[model samples]
Target: MKRCFTALIALTGAALPSASGQGHSALVQLQAHHSQADLEHMEEHAHYRYVGELLFYSSSFLVEEGGVERAATEQEVLGIDLHAHDGLRMVDQRIAVHDPLIDKHIILLSRNEFGALVLERLSPLDRDAFLANKRATMEQPSSKTQ
Candidate 1:
């Protein structure tokens, strides 16, 4: 099995509203493709694409949809809504949390015929512990680094 991924950086990406109600970050588009090895295979490869966005508030970021704040599950990342096609198929998706001191990152993972980690999304973990750490950092005077 062979696979390829293409990321389309939006030239005019939409801005996400921060916790302060101001737009700060841009949403990026991502695409994943998979094809079979056998030349006899008649079916075309499968392609998936979606726009990724994250909302920052206080000291953390969360996946936002229609102004609603929530964690991005596996389904939120790779679930295709388009019409069904013939060829390889997406097998499964998973979400994992990685905690490193104050910075906790959440990773979205997907599996398909191409490979186990066909797609992934790295995002900040939204939790009280992380929020507190971020808030403290934000409140600190900038002179410390100077």
Candidate 2:
């Protein structure tokens, strides 16, 4: 498993390989080659099936539930917490992330004293930008060692 990761990192970009593994990074990479509608449909379907859901996209989450539902603005969210949750034991294991057995990151963009703020924002990106960043990242050197 580690060897595979090493090879993938070597093949892709080396810089910030850790951050590149975050929830959003997957979407960015996929969207680089896919249509936005297809991406949305898949993520929404994944959420419905309790397979896997996107954690963040600039502001929008691939799926939303309970408290954290959407992309939040600075004023709308004072701070955020990324934790783990053990649901009904259904969410699929993504990229060898043995979530339920291990701890998964559950993101929270909490409300303020007034109430949850209605953020006026756009989706962090469309396919074009995602691909551009991905291309750039792939060209960078791996800075941190495994």
Candidate 3:
């Protein structure tokens, strides 16, 4: 079963379009390609489903600030908590990270083949939308199987 799954992933990854086009880095292409509709398209692949769950999750990020690389503080990591049920959302290779340090600044992070996390994009989340998402998640019942 493990071998079969691995084979499936290799094949599926090969079938996806090449994102390493000229002028744009692979990460940039992936970010641009993974719109809501593109994500829906990727959802059909078994590899996407399996690998999405298997990617690494980090609690602290080493980010460059003022010409110096420093680890992000807990507050700088945004929407990150050891006890929170879910902190990050991943689709394909991109994950959304919310940092509350600057008015809910959200960044999309991508995991490279070498397992390093890279920042792809940064966008601000409106306060109202953020609150709404929080409320909706809190209202949902747990889907735990056991």
Candidate 4:
């Protein structure tokens, strides 16, 4: 009985999904193309979802929420921005209506008390790809062990 239980546990553990493993390779490929400045800019903004060429930022603000009643101080707003110049050409404008997670990021862009862009989320795939490529490039062959 103990042997059977152990086997079942092992099988279950093996079958469980690993969210990090599936998409990381593709993400690594994607990151190779971006520059450090581009990454820093994205990081400064709020969490964003990558849908094709656009990054959408969404946040709940203090504003009226419903009708007939007094406008609530809080409201939710979605903001969209174009990330790539090539991708921008495909869209009608540089900015558009915020659409929720069509890709990866969930938080989207967030604003401060003064209404300035403060945080942004990168797609996990994008991050993984970027870091992996960087690691690979930084690896060097050495003739002597130190």
Identify the leading candidate in terms of lDDT.
3
TM-score of each: 0.20, 0.21, 0.23, 0.22
Model 4 Cα shift for residue 100 (angstroms): 32
Off by over 4 Å in 1: 1-12, 18-91, 109-146
Q: How well is each residue in 1-146 modelled by candidate 3, as lDDT tens digits? A: 35324423432243223211211222232334356554444333333322332221221233444455543333333323312313453443533344443333333443342123211110122223334544566777463211
Order of candidates by TM-score, top first?
A: 3, 4, 2, 1
Q: Write the per-residue lDDT of candidate 1 for residues 1-146, one digit (tens) a residue.
A: 12221212221123322211211221211212322232113112112211122211111222444545554332332332211211222346433343332233433232332221112321122123334444566898562311
Q: How many pairs collide in each candidate, listed in order?
A: 0, 4, 1, 21
Candidate 3: count of backbone clashes, pairs at least 3 residues apart or interchain: 1
What are the lDDT scores of the predictions, listed in order? 0.26, 0.30, 0.32, 0.27
lDDT tens digits by residue: candidate 4, 1-146? 34223322321233324312212322232245455555434434311212111212122111222322121111121221223212322222222222242221222222232122112223455445544544565684442211
- Stretch of 10 with least lDDT, candidate 2: 113-122
Per-residue lDDT of model 2, residues 44-124, tens digit only: 432211112222322221123353333333322122321232222233321111223213333333222101111111122
Angstrom error of the Cα, residue 31, model 4: value is 1.8
Model 2 lDDT on a 0 to 1 scale: 0.30
**What's every prediction's RMSD, in angstroms?**
21.0, 17.4, 15.2, 16.8
Clashing pairs in 2: 14-142, 15-142, 59-71, 83-106
Segments in model 4 whose C-alpha atoms lie over 4 Å from true places = 1-16, 49-146
Using lDDT as the measure, name the better of candidate 1 and candidate 2.
2
Span of ten consecutive residues with least summed lDDT in model 3: 114-123
